[model samples]
Structure formats: structure tokens, C-alpha cells
Target: MPGETVQPTPPGPAPVPVPGTLVVDTSRGDRLGEFRGAAGPYWSLRAVCGGVEWEAEPGAVRRATRKERLHAEIERWNARSRGEVL
Candidate 1:
């Protein structure tokens, strides 16, 4: 093993979602965010309430369920009301 070479694993294919579509990144604790676009090998997602974007692996991202979408909308509204997001 001393002279053995190692190889890096390629990123897995992720489902592509339209921009502005709500999605859930299960790998990120089910964080709800809006799909921005592809970020190299990862997908770009930002909080529905508006905040810094985070890169999620394609395999970990999926369209938000109806319930999740509603919840995210409600969270956005709550943030807006509290002046935490505009």
C-alpha cells in the first residue's frame, strides 16, 4: 500500500431544478431554499427567507414537497415581519 495511488470520487449526478424553485437539501438538515443554479459540481441554494447561499450536492437536493413549500413561504413571511428578511 505504500506505493499505491488513490483516486478522487467524482460528484454524483443531481437533479436539475429551475431557478427560483423551492427545494430541500436533505443533507443540510432538510433546509429549505430556493434553487439558484448550478455551482460547478454542486447545486446552489439559498434560504427562502433570503440569506447567504450554500452549495448542496446534487444527490442531496430535491424539489420541496407541497408542505415544505408552504412552510418555507410561512418562514419567509415571518422573517419579513420581523425585519430579518425583505
Candidate 2:
């Protein structure tokens, strides 16, 4: 133990952004905030849905759906809008 070097503990995982809180995107990454317009474009408000807490981007966010049905819907909409039969 006399000559042994005790290495310092490495930093832990970053904190989870709190729900209902805004965060700023610093060069070091996200930090908590109570209001918007104080953060950069890469930053966003934190939220929780379906029992999971996560950061959300601006605008509409929806639950993930099956790919086949999702693609089919898109195709149907495109066809209808183009006046083509589906």
C-alpha cells in the first residue's frame, strides 16, 4: 500500500433530465432548467409517457406503431391526395 497509487473514481452516468423541466444544451450536455427560451436548439423539455421518462423534441410526438400498418396508411394517404385509386 505504501507505493500503490489510488486512482480517483471516474464520473458516473449523467443525470436523467427531470420531468416537466427544461434543459439547456451546454458544451458538456443537458442541464436542468425551469423555463424555456434559455436553452439552445439541441436542448428540449423533459417529459414522461408510458411509464418512461425521456426528453422530447419540439412538436408532435406519438407512440410507436407497427411498420406495416404505418407504411400502408402513408401509402393510402398519398394515393388519395394524388387522386389515384389505392
Candidate 3:
């Protein structure tokens, strides 16, 4: 271990705040959430339907086009239902 280099663990997901546009994730059967800032090292998002909130790691906030975002959101919803968090 003396010569080994330890890399710091990466941070949690951050919200990519897109103001004023309502995003619907049909795959999840629910609407995509709104950005509500960070909670500790995790980024928080508030799903409009039923007011459900969730946090994701920072890697999730990578810049994406509108179409990419929508596709990602749909995939996210599907993943969530399958007990997988992206």
C-alpha cells in the first residue's frame, strides 16, 4: 500500500436546473422533477406529481440537449421502477 495512490470518491449527482419547462417522463409514468438544490453531497430534485423528492449524484448533471435530457429522464424513471437508480 505504500506506493498505491488513493483517489477521492466522486461526489453525488447534482440537479441540472432548466427553468420554466415542464418535463414529462412517459416511461416512468410520471413527470420529471424540478431542481431544488443540493442536500449534503447529493443533488435534490422534487417530482411534481405527489410532491415526491429524490436525490442523485453529481455525475447525473452532465450537460445534455433537450432531447437527450428527455430520453435520459425516461430511462431514469424506468430504472427507478426496476429498483435501479441512475
Best-fitting candidate, measured by lDDT? Answer: 1
Per-model TM-score, in order, reads: 0.74, 0.29, 0.36
What shift in Å separates residue 23 of candidate 1 from its native position after superposition? Answer: 0.7
Model 2 per-residue lDDT tens digits across residues 1-86: 79999999996534444443433323224322222221433234332111223344432222223553355456557777888743
Candidate 2: the clashing residue pairs are: none
Screening candidate 1 with a backbone cut-off below 3 angstroms (N, C-alpha, C), the clashing residue pairs are none
Rank by TM-score, highest first.
1, 3, 2
Per-model lDDT: 0.87, 0.39, 0.56
- Most TM-score-accurate candidate: 1
State the weakest 10-residue window (summed lDDT) of model 3.
20-29
* lDDT (tens digit, per residue) of candidate 3 on 1-86: 89999999986544445543344333344435555666787656665333566665555444335875677568668877988644
Model 3's lDDT to the true fold? 0.56
The runs of at least 3 residues in candidate 2 whose Cα sits more than 4 Å from the true structure, single-residue gaps closed, are 28-86
Error of 3 at 1 (Å): 36
